[model samples]
Target: MGRKNDIASAVIMLGVALFLAGCPKQALEPVGAGGPQPQAQPQQESPAMTPEQPAMQMEPYGGASGQGAVRLDQARQDFQDADIMFEYDSFSLTAEAKKVLAEKARFLNAHPGMKVLIEGHCDERGTAEYNLALGERRAKAAQEYLVFLGVNAQRLSTISYGEEKPLDPEANEAAWAKNRRAHFVITEG
Candidate 1:
């Protein structure tokens, strides 16, 4: 029984080591070896500090003052300038859509204060309910791609306008292609 327990313990230790090895290089390193870790920082002010003096201050999204706010507003405008389109009856993003999403992610990352609402729209082909669900999937796909590109998840939201909100109400292929898109709306900046 003792020998069996020893083997089990060794196996567990080996598994743990293998799991850690698969983790990112930064995760495996000791904190502070490269730079200060956020978790290691003291949450409270130093005891030597007096109420008369201000503690270390962190700047807002872009900068310290209204400059940041103005930049964020500009980023929001830039975000709205592009729309990511999807194929008919499909939620998958094309190469063009990915390029647009990459740009959107950059802007969203730069303006952390900016909040986006991704509205998914479909053409007037499928049933309203089916189109709504498809639209939701399309919006979620865009949201996931943006998050992957380093945009903060908290700043993004999604909604499905479905076939109800076609950019072109015409029943042609070109109009349908144009309508099947994920539209970006700046909810907050």
Candidate 2:
């Protein structure tokens, strides 16, 4: 009985030793042969540039000549919302243009007192007179669409700037496409 008890105790001790040997170390010790271990630290990040950052090139706008005027930022937003476009020498609105005009009309209808001036533009392709006429047609097209969409005609007007007010002055297809557009300007109280 004494021998059996000794054997059992030896077996238990052997099992515990094996189990501990197989387990991962709970405490880490620094190695004397190598340098100190690196401490974890938060990484520093570079500053990010945002839209509020100053533009490289800024154009200056003169003060309003009339009684009531719209903010330049608001005008820009209106122009974006308008999205008026024309085909080569065509005054008719495309399906997409009509959709955009519908939204514009809805906006104008909502703001009954607001007045908008549509400025017709042209690419530097046709004769000055022809371009002017084309511009008028384009502006009128947008104005008519607004009227059709229930915006009061009395609250809207059209102007033909022709090729004079080119959004992109470059003589490329992209510039031409950009220049050939009908833009919005708020001209009244």
Candidate 3:
């Protein structure tokens, strides 16, 4: 307990020193613990056209009604519930995977405060080492694509579960097809 206090104190001191030394306030926002706090930006005038590009709609949030929070909760759930599936033994993104990823990128862009964890999984056919490596490749591929789509690289992370956890546990092509996927998890928002 005493050691933990000393470490915490040292960290606080370092933070203070950095602040005094002119680090940007926004860059120091805490990660994981309390999630990303929403920034308050001044409202700007809007002129709209183009049916192809939909304008961002504002929703009532906080205060007396909790609808906004509920909507956000649902959106987060949907984001993770939607998985990016890969073909057997392949880390390459399919057309369907690209479409899903594009929608995910749009969601992430809207919610800049979110931090996502991309989990790479595999079917049981491969050896453990091979599966792990393949899983890593799949996760990195998704991360790279997301980064290319304008998500902050710092806001995303990746881990390989390999063949350990499968969405469908039965030994068959259908189950294996389900298992070969890159799953999304919201670590913080």
Candidate 4:
């Protein structure tokens, strides 16, 4: 602890000295023709340069915004878009789903401040009640896998959307496959 304090003190002293040295002499000078003149007019800031607008702004996958929110939203979309599929009529995650969850776990671990909601969805087939139950199972399956992969359980929540929302609304095998999956939304970052 003594050594850490000494190092911290030295760093602080060095920073103060550098800051003093970096002071502009012109700033101290009187404002006159013989002294430093007024600066040129400032240019308008581009949207990307603004603090409120991120440079890599993406189409938000869900409603989330604030400091580091764009990055959080992107991460959420990337996880949900990993194609973590389940077998027809089953809530159990496949091998591919495990692989996707592993990647999501890594992402979540890196951003400990982030919180997310996992939405469970299903293909249009079973009765509404059955689909809702299946959806909950699917969401739980994902949440459990994430917890096993070392993500904090407190940072995750689950919801069952059942078949109410579909990525592809068309009545076809392709659309059904698209709809039967878990989705992610970032609640905080």
Candidate 5:
């Protein structure tokens, strides 16, 4: 029994590693070795903080405040936080889902270079096979709606988690409703 359990654990770990390896590339920001990072240049504070204060501040590139970075971060947060929800056993988009997708479409249009991954998920009431298909349909529904709203289809990819990943694990209508959603991830920009 112990050996069997060990093998199961090993298999699960391997599956997770493989899944992560197959996932879309990380954020547009460079990663690992050989990536050039912005270096900070020492600059005098502009009446905000006196030099007498023993604190160091880095000047942003291009002489602009970090407002651009902040805005981009907020936009990314807003994008990921907004999920397109669906009814049980149905892949149809509600009016609210369409509105949310419209807002997402606007964000995508503003950031033309961004690429996204849409993940479809489901409640825990169905067989894995059935849920996977339903989840895929839900994801595709959202993707189609985004395309209809003028966001390029090429920028979007879809995957279904089905009942494998529930937003709320509790067995209740609210939890089930929360789990039936299409989530978003920014793959690259």
Candidate 6:
């Protein structure tokens, strides 16, 4: 009976050992030359992904105290020869517009005694009131830039004709672009 009991206990121990051997092994340390794998890097955020700001921001023009003598004929000529373009539905001057204005400024500086009126115009897109406002904005932008470029504020005046005066009369992009401008007319002459 003792021998039988001993044999049963030995069988039970063998079964326990087989069960543990069949179980999966836990990894105690990293494997080969690759070692511990590095974690994936997070993606960087981009400025382009963000929404843009509003377009109506007006920069302040430092007033006209630093002006010099300018040529009248040259200024008039430059004003006549200057070509300014605006974006669709906008009166803001682009880099090209700025370059033209700079030349105009040089002319104005040469002719200091010349007093001119800047006529603001717009294409026939919106209501008269809206167009008038846009035209005024264009005129004011030109005037302010001139002031910044050392042209006397007193010599510069602004007016808005809105869509009333169409330079091309044709209802096309070129005509509309032509209409959306700040034209100079010598008011004091």
In terms of lDDT, the poorest run of 10 residues in model 4 is 22-31
Residue 131's lDDT within candidate 5 is 98
Q: Give a tens-digit lDDT track for model 5, residues 11-124.
A: 777554433322211112432222222232122123323333222222211123444344456667889998989998999999999999999998787556689999999999
Task: List the global CA lDDT of all models.
Answer: 0.70, 0.64, 0.74, 0.67, 0.74, 0.62
Task: Give all TM-scores, in the order shown.
Answer: 0.61, 0.58, 0.70, 0.62, 0.68, 0.58
**How well does candidate 1 score on lDDT at residue 141?**
98
Residue-level lDDT of model 3, residues 28-130, one tens digit each, is: 2333233323232212112212232232333223122434455566677789999999998999999999999999999887666679999999999989999
Q: Which candidate, 2 or 3, has the higher lDDT? A: 3
Q: Residue 155 in model 1: shift from native, Å?
A: 0.9
Q: Give the range of the ten consecutive residues with the poorest summed lDDT in model 5.
A: 53-62
Deviation in angstroms for 80 in model 3? 0.5
After TM-score superposition, the amount by which residue 167's alpha carbon in candidate 2 deviates from its true location, in angstroms, is 0.3
Q: Per-residue lDDT of 71-172 in model 6, one digit per residue for the tens?
A: 223434657756576776688889998998898887666444467888888888778999899888999999999999999899999999999997889988
lDDT of 5 at 73: 68
lDDT of 5 at 13: 71
Between 2 and 3, whose TM-score is larger?
3
Residue 101 displacement in candidate 2 (angstroms) = 0.4
Specify the poorest-scoring 10-residue window by lDDT in model 2.
Answer: 22-31
Supply candidate 4's per-residue lDDT for 34.
Answer: 33
Give candidate 5's TM-score.
0.68
In model 5, state the lDDT of residue 113: 68
How big is the positional error of residue 13 in model 4, measured in Å on the Cα after superposition? Answer: 12
* Model 6 root-mean-square deviation: 29.9
Model 3, which residues run further than 4 Å from truth? 1-56, 60-63
Single out the weakest 10-residue window by summed lDDT for candidate 6.
Answer: 54-63
Clashes found in each candidate (C-alpha, N, C closer than 3 A): 0, 0, 0, 0, 0, 7
Model 1 has an lDDT value of 0.70
CA RMSD of each candidate after superposition: 16.6, 25.3, 14.5, 14.8, 20.5, 29.9
Root-mean-square deviation of Cα positions for candidate 2 versus the true structure, in angstroms: 25.3
